[model samples]
Target: MLTHLALKDFAVVQSAELAFGPGLTVISGETGAGKSLLVDALGLLSGLRADSGVVRHGASRAELVAEFSLADAQPATDWLRENALDEDGDDGRHCQVRRVVRADGGSRTWINGRPVTVGQLAELASHLVEIHGQHEHQALLSRPSQLALLDAYARNDAERRAVAEAAGRWSDLLAERERLTAQGDVSDRIGWLEHQHAELERETLDADSLAQLSIDHRRSAHAAGLLEACERAFAVMDGDEGPSITRALRQARDTLQRVAEHEPRLNEVDTMLDNAAIQLDEAAVLLDRIRGDLDLDPQALEALEQRMGRLHELARKHRVTPEQLAAKRDEIATELEALRGADERLQGLDADIAAATRAWQAAAEVLGATRRDAARRLSSDTSALIAELGMGGGAFDVVLEVLETVRPDPQGAERVEFMVAANPGQPPRPLRKVASGGELSRISLAIEVAALGLDAVPTMVFDEVDSGIGGAVADIVGQKLRALGERRQVLCVTHLPQVAAQGHAHYRVSKSASDGVTQSEVQALGAKQRQDELARMLGGVEMTREARAAARRLLSDAG
Candidate 1:
């Protein structure tokens, strides 16, 4: 329920604050007195777009604030908690929304003193208040809205979900079938894949095999140079021919050992010669081993080069490097297997599509039945209300037009349209075609009243919805609004005295020009003040005795 609203430098209102409680609250004023300004303020706080034109002439910005009690608004409370915007006051039964609109047309919103995006604010506001503008009656003309309202009234969430899920399954299967059919024949593609697979399978593409092949190719390419160098080194170092490194080193070591007893320094030289002789012998052995292992066969070299060339060609054909050949081969084999089974899979798809279609039809049937039952009840109830709202002999009907299509529809099997006949013995037509704005307003109200508690919103605001209505009909409208207030907080802006008199709380908006600047003011009225305001509304500029008496009677009867 709305607890308070405050507006600062917004439109023609310089400043104003109003306190609200449970039950019907009405705002009324003379012509051009800015009675709807309060409603506009609430709308801004509800996340409506802002404009620079709404700012007062000299003000830099406009501020709007609204406070609601969450005691009865469990949905809103849960939303705040889930969003981490809840506070620890009143055990989390308090919420405050503030919006600031700058003169440049930019605006910002806050919930519980924490800044938020407009989308977030709108989401939170949905559970707190529902504002029905004077012109929002046109919303009833939309077929989708009519269908949604019926579903809401029927409480058919489970049925709707089932239908939607079944339709999704059917659509997915149909898409798969279409894809398979679009592929035409894959025989040629499959044959190409098999040929490529065979070519890749003949090659050794693993890392170890490629590395060893590279090594053998290098060794064969340098075989002649390696063999010649190894033989010369072995002959010069360890050979028995002429003077050699090993023989010279041994003679130098023996001569140094003989002088070691005479000079200690000569002993170090003898040890160096001995080490050099040992190193030469080890070098000759390694050279001999390498020369024996080297393969000088040209044919073997040619075979390794052929293998490398084939690997390169394959990599180029597949748009991959040699290192990726193994993975690419496996990928081709998998795709080839799948193509070979395409016909079999396509045959399976036909049965799957048929089963999905059956499931969707079954769910749609149940949903359609539920809608029909709800449509009948909603139509009968709204028709009775239309008559009560001074459209006697009027009839309202909910028409479910069966759709003709072979595909599954998520919205069930029918299209819903609201039909109405505003006079007795006349054929009902689409509600959208109703001529009079007054009749449309009344019908909208009638439907809302008929399905009042179906919505979970804690507050409802009606902005001059009683327009084009007066006298006893207006009185009935007022009574209905008051009754609606019994279950939900209602704020109504009206010019009708009959409607004003029904409010448990009343406020009057008045404007005055001060130093060439016009400002609007709002004041909550007491019994005497409320009576006078009603008299003014009833009798216009002059306060007539008869009008005061009528106002008093209206209030007495309303009590």
Candidate 2:
């Protein structure tokens, strides 16, 4: 339950701290007394969008904080844990939400003093409190909200889950079928893949073979020039005209060897010259072997050229470099395999889709049946409640219409509409179109009282629920609000003294101005003070003796 609200520099409320308790808390005052400002502050703390205009004239920022005791709120506790916003080491019985809005239009929010995103704050607040007023009544007029309310009251969890599961399966199967059909329609692409595969296959190319072929092609391309160069080198090193340089070196080495006994340096020079002559003879033999090996084969050259050209052409066709051609080929092969087996896969998907459709239909039928049963009970209960609220001869009904085909949705195929007949002998019509504001409030109150146990939120606020009604009707409205308070904390902003007298706690809002600034203040009233306020409400600006007597009687009767 919401335990306390602390607001500062927010609208006309410069600073205020209000403590709340269980049961009906009524806020009553004249119009423009900032009663709605308090609600707006609570809304801001509950993660509603903040407005800079809410900041007071002199304050740079406005702060709103709400403290909720979660000792009985298991759903909210679980939600906090799930979102990792649980307080550490502290008892799990309390949660605090704080919101701050700067005068410059910037806003920040916190949960238990820890910073949190506004979205997270909103999510957490949803499980803790429900604000139902004129705005919510407008929302209830929507068909979607009508359907949801019916489902909630019906407690059709298992049926809803079954429909959800079936819908998910059907959606998955449809996606798979689409994918398989797309793949199977690519038969024309298979021919192109085959052509690419054949082109690579004819080459029979391997890394080692390609390397050797490239080497041979380069050597063969320059064979004539290479042979001529080698021949010239060999002739220079070992020509047979007067023994050439080798013979001259050998002769000089022999003469030096004979004078080695007279000079050791001469012997070293002779040894070096002999080594040079031997190296020259070895070079001539190597040159002769290289010249013999040199062969210029045009056939091999033409084959290498054709192979390179084909590689380049394939690379361009595939929009890839030659090095990536292998990877591209593997990808295409995989795609071709999928296309070839698409028919079988698509058949499997069709069977799955059929099974899913049957499952969805069965679940939807079960849900529709449950809704019909629930609608009967709900209509009887709401009709009784409406009569109790001073609406004589009013008939409330829940109209459930089933779609022709099963729709893939968790909420099933039934469309629910709240139909009502406001007066005797009048035909029932959609609640939104037929009910006046006053009638709508009464109907909403009846539905809320009926579905109180189904709701998880601990606190419910009703603003202007007594609009357009008075006398006995207002007394009945107060009775219903008081009864709702027994199950959940109800805060009603009302103008009727009868309703205010019925409150477990009463607060009176009054506006005052000083130094050209206006502000509103709320004070919780005691029994005597409540009677005085009730008298004031009965007789505006002045409380007459008869009005005080009536107010006293109203309070006594309310007790």
Candidate 3:
């Protein structure tokens, strides 16, 4: 249950902290007194989006926090445990959710002080609160919500899962069939793939071989210039015309050795000259070997150019680099192989689709019966409740119609709609089309009470659910809400004294503006204070003796 709520600069609330308890807690206030603002703050606990627009004027941001005691909320506790969101070294009996909205339209959320996604917050809150807004009538008018409510009421989760799974398998097979059909003219594609495959398979085109080939091509291209440079060097070193470097070094060594017998320093110089002459001779021999090996064969160069040109052409045709062509060829080959067995696969898919369709039909028939029966009972119970809410002679029906297609749907074989007639002798129409805003609120309240049988949420909030209802009927609505509170927590923001008097605890919300800043405040009322407020609600601007007496009678009867 929601234990405490705190708001900072949220709407015109300024700042407020409220501690709540189990049972029917009623909030009453004049219209525009921000009675529903309390509901809005609680809605934030459900991960509803907020922005600076929801912040009070001149505030930079809005902050909200809610606490829930999970003594009985096992589903929510289980969710926290599964997601690792529970606090350490503590029993999983308490949870705190906080949300902050910045003026720049940014927001942050936290669960137990740990940052969390809004989706996770919303999922956790679903088990904690079920809020019915005055304008959420669209949910009642929607077909999907109707079907979901029926299934939930029927508690046919197993049957529903079976139908959904069967439909999924059937849809998968159909999707595969469509994909193959769209790939038209498989034979042509396969033929092209085969040609490319043969080329790649027949050639050795790995990265290492390609790199070696690049080096060989460059060497062959520059062979003529390289051979000329090497021959000139050899001519200079071997002294083909003048004294070569080797011959000059030899002459220097001979002159130095003649003086070496007289001076030891001269011997060292002669030794260095001898080493230079030997290195020059070795260089000349290397030049001769390189010159002999050099070749500029026109036919061999032409073969290399043709090979490289073919690789480049294929790369361009496939819109890839030369290195990527091999991989792309293999990918196409794999697809082509699959196409070769398309006939066999298509036959298999047909058989699987037929089997899946049969399974779906079987599940749908079983689940559909439960849904229709639940729908009938739901409609009947809801209609009976509305009749007591001052809509005498009103009638409600749950219409189950088959979908337009023959294929099975995850939601079973039919769509459910809520139909109602507001008065006798009138044709039943869509609930929204038949009821005005006031009637819709009463109808929604009835539906909520009936659906509460299936809802496991720990808290239910109704904002002015008693709208456009008064007198004995308002008293009935209050009694029903009080009875619901016995099952779980119930919070209601009401304007009717009849409803207010039935509250296990009463709170009065008042709006005040000071220095052009508006603020709303709520305070728990004492017995005398509640009586005075109920009197004011009963008599409006003036609380006469009769209104006070009526308020007392209401409090007494409610007790």
| lDDT: worst 10-residue window of model 1 | 132-141
* Better candidate by TM-score, 1 or 3: 1
Q: TM-score of predicted model 3?
A: 0.65
Put down candidate 2 lDDT per residue, 1-559, tens digits, no spaces.
Answer: 9999888988888888889999999999989998867777767776788879999888999999999999768888998888778888866789999999999989999998889999888778777776656553344577886777678788998898888888888988898888777664666787877887777666635566657767877787788889888877766666543457877787788777887899878877877887887788788788888899987788877877777788778889889876677777778778878777777778888888888999898888898898999889889999988887777899999999877764477678878999998778989999878546667777878878877646667887777778877898889889889889988898888898888888999988888997999988889898899999999988887999998999999988888
User: Model 2, 163: alpha-carbon shift in Å?
Assistant: 1.6
What TM-score fits each model?
Answer: 0.72, 0.67, 0.65
Where does candidate 2 stray beyond 4 Å?
46-50, 71-83, 90-93, 104-106, 111-123, 136-139, 185-342, 393-395, 404-406, 420-436, 538-559
The TM-score ranking, best first, is: 1, 2, 3
lDDT value, residue 247 of candidate 3: 71
- Full ranking by lDDT: 1, 3, 2
Which candidate, 2 or 3, would have the higher TM-score against the true structure?
Answer: 2
Writing each residue's lDDT as its tens digit, candidate 3 over 218-327 gives 87888999998997787777788578887788788888787788889998788788788777778777878888888989888888888888888888878898888778
Q: Worst 10-residue stretch by lDDT in candidate 3?
A: 133-142
Any idea what lDDT model 2 has?
Answer: 0.82
Preferred candidate (lDDT higher): 2 or 3 = 3
lDDT of each: 0.87, 0.82, 0.84
**What shift in Å separates residue 349 of candidate 2 from its native position after superposition?**
2.3
Regions of model 1 farther than 4 Å from truth: 1-11, 14-25, 37-133, 136-138, 207-293, 453-459, 468-479, 482-490, 496-507, 516-518, 523-559
Candidates 1 and 2 compared: the better one by lDDT is 1
**Best prediction by TM-score:** 1
